[model samples]
Target: MANSANALPETGFLRLPQIVGNPHANPPIPAIVPVCRSAWWLGVREGRYPKPVKLGPRTTAWRIEDIRALIASL
Candidate 1:
């Protein structure tokens, strides 16, 4: 069976893992794009990736719509 971890939802936000993935987990969370967290952040800083929204004091996430547009551009 294919790993469903890479699958994205139609809407809502995505966390770092749900974007870059956590493949080492027991279920092996898949990645929509294979990238290191540091590089991802760098891309974000460089405007190559989507901007994150501050959900809380320590929470940050990206919108699925933004992510979809990014994937389309890629």
Candidate 2:
């Protein structure tokens, strides 16, 4: 999972396992993309990073808020 903007390393915060682990606790990119693709086709998928929302022209991003909330709910 892509780290939240608040969790970026350039923010000068400690790189602890717990915090980083929070996002990766789900799965890495290798496992996530396949499901994300399927979810994109199914319309029931959620929590995909870097492809959250569709911007105009040619852009996309995973709504960080959605992924975080989904994680929290889980």
Candidate 1 per-residue lDDT over residues 1-74, each given as its tens digit: 12332366778998999888898988987788789999999999999999999999999999988888888777
lDDT of each: 0.84, 0.38
Model 2 per-residue lDDT tens digits across residues 1-74: 33343353332222122222334455532332224444443543442322344565565444545444544443
Model 2, residue 2: displacement in angstroms?
A: 13
Q: State, as a TM-score between 0 and 1, how close model 1 is to the true structure.
A: 0.87
lDDT at 71, model 1: 81
- Candidate topping lDDT: 1
Alpha-carbon TM-score of each model against the true structure = 0.87, 0.36
Q: Model 2 scores what on Cα lDDT?
A: 0.38
CA RMSD, predictions in order: 3.3, 9.6
The residue-level lDDT of candidate 1 at 27 comes to 92
Q: Per-residue lDDT for 5 in model 1?
A: 28
Q: What is the lDDT of residue 6 in candidate 1?
A: 34
